[model samples]
Target chain A: MQKDSQKTKLRPGQLSRPKNLNLFTIRLPINALVSILHRATGCVLFLILPVILLLLQFSLSSAQHYETVIAILHSPFIKLMLLGLAWAFFHHFFAGIRHLAMDVHWMTTLMKARYTSKVVLVLGVLATLVLAVKIWM
Target chain B: MLIELLTKRYPGMRAWLTQRLSALVMAVYSVFAVARFLIVQPNSYEAWVDFFQPLWWRIATLLFWISLCIHAWLGIRDVFKDYVPNPSVRDVLDKLLVVSLWVYLVWATWLLLG
Candidate 1:
């Protein structure tokens, strides 16, 4: 049959289809960028769980320990690291909310999704900026 | 139809719903926590201790941690499934993830209630 011949021809074409895996060569759309960042930030937040717990325990143990924890957090390098982690949290928070909204049939269109993606990114940065000011000013 | 999707017949749907539900819990908690912190402004050791002293607050915190563990487990499992193609390696990673999440859950429970 003609359909059988077409199927036979398609097999070789599919097998020879070009594959690109180089990450740098592939430009991600805004939604994709937000989506991947959400996952990356989630991993970051999960990995830091132990550190957060340790710091909370240390800060709660005694007055002196609390002071020491405060001092450590206030150090310049640690403050920078904290700001980075805060950004991660903020990004994950906003992007996760956007995803939830989409799940409930809100902003399901491509253009609106892209707009929400930018909103999430900007809100994440804006939140970190506010926290930076709170920390340093 | 919704109940059927969440039943044992459709495990992927169950997992999807769990992830979303856990996310909702955590999101609400995060907002509440920030607002509470701003209002309390726990500036001293005593104040900080007091911030956590309330029994209800501690219970809420525990619930947040539980949601967090569930959320993390599902998220990391999906990450492993996507990136780790080798079945054996993925299995090991999956076990590791489960073990670590349990340890965290235990630690959090002890911290909050112990």
Candidate 2:
């Protein structure tokens, strides 16, 4: 009975703790930013699977449909949206490679990890910029 | 050791390894795809069709799709687990995810092979 009372006093219930749910107040570290973006981009990529499949099917269906798909993709608004999606893909891809590297115990230190995080972000944007240039000019 | 971790006893380990392996596979394929696209410069419909004409290319694409389905399934399932606190709602979403991925797998198979 004494031990049980002590346990209760020592460990207050979870609800008694203070909570701050404001997302804006939370400052995410560089590694954390990359990690969360990886997850977000992953979800975005997964959601677009059906559209990709549909586009692929339509493109392969006939020459007319293929040209139509090409024309749709060549539009200005669609090109911008495609750029955004391309960035998401590039971010996810590079960040994912970083993650796999960490899994194998590479760049596991705080400083090295941060450097690689920056590298991943820069590479993603650089690749997207290259693609944008290829698409436009 | 390695084999032990991949068995049914440690399902999370299996998922972890699977995710990494799939990521590697997709990474290789993505690089190859970009290189091929740049080299082939498939600007016309005929050129594009020819780009996918090789049986080996189709097989590799099919493998990539399979890996994608598995990776997406595991990744999205974890996302739902993390964000969705309600068990029943998460369960429904999980079922929907599996069904949709399976449908996509079938659709991709048909598109690629049929």
Candidate 3:
């Protein structure tokens, strides 16, 4: 009776810390990671808007400015950033579609949802690669 | 009856449907645009102009721009709806956002192809 009373008073044990900081962490599920990525990508795109606008402004200013913008884009740092942007854009784009599909009652099953998310990630990588190769070559 | 009830609770069925449809369109358009930009890769000003000079390519670019505008509108609308509680304020902001997005899209398209 005393032990039972103590159990009630003590409550549950503290949860263990997450296993890893990497993608394989036990605490962060795939859906949660994707959700976080969606928000992160959205913010990244928001930030990129001004950069995009600057490029457009430069490109439209004159032939000289256009050449300058082209030169800037060809820089290694800019290339890396563009690659990241491409990946994020594709990821957000596909994940948004998946979310919309879920809203409409398509691919809502647990198994299907997992599969769809995986497919979207794979497709995003493939699309990014295609873009990368085209840009680099 | 259940569907009707649910739709009523959500409201804006048309908005939701159009948003999803636009997103799907944009997804496909993005893939193609990325591929096109990569493959032809107009490395020079004349090459870029040549790529843009094609009538069909211009049309495709126009469609992609439209898709992007629509997708962004839908996505931002959701964000505003979620964050803004007052209906009047949300409505005004939503309208403003849509207008601004259209303006930006028009401007960008003109600069790119013009």
Per-prediction TM-score to the true structure, in the order listed:
0.94, 0.93, 0.69
Q: Show model 2 residue runs off by greater than 4 Å.
A: A1-18
Error of 2 at A16 (Å): 5.6
In CAPRI terms, model 1 is classed as: high
Indicate the worst ten consecutive residues by lDDT in candidate 1 chain A.
A10-19
**lDDT by residue for model 3 (B54-92), tens:** 778777767766776776777677777778999999999
DockQ of 3: 0.31
Q: Can you write out model 2's per-residue Cα lDDT over A1-137, one digit (the tens) per residue?
A: 45665766645553333569999999999999999999999999999999999999999888999999999999999999999999999999999999988888999999999999999999999999999998999
User: What is the Å distance of residue A96 in model 2 from its true position?
Assistant: 0.6
TM-scores for chain A over all candidates:
0.89, 0.87, 0.81
Give the Cα-based TM-score of candidate 2 against the true structure.
0.93
- Return the clash pairs for model 2, or none: none
List per-prediction Cα lDDT, in the order shown. 0.95, 0.94, 0.76
Residue pairs that clash (backbone atoms under 3 angstroms), model 3: none
Q: What would the per-residue lDDT of candidate 2 be over residues B10-101, giving only the tens digit for each residue? A: 99999999989998999999999999988999988889889888989999999999999999999999999999999999999999999999
**Backbone steric clashes in candidate 2, count:** 0
Q: How well is candidate 1 docked (DockQ)?
A: 0.85
Better of 2 and 3 by lDDT: 2
Q: Report, to 2 decimal places, the DockQ of model 2.
A: 0.82
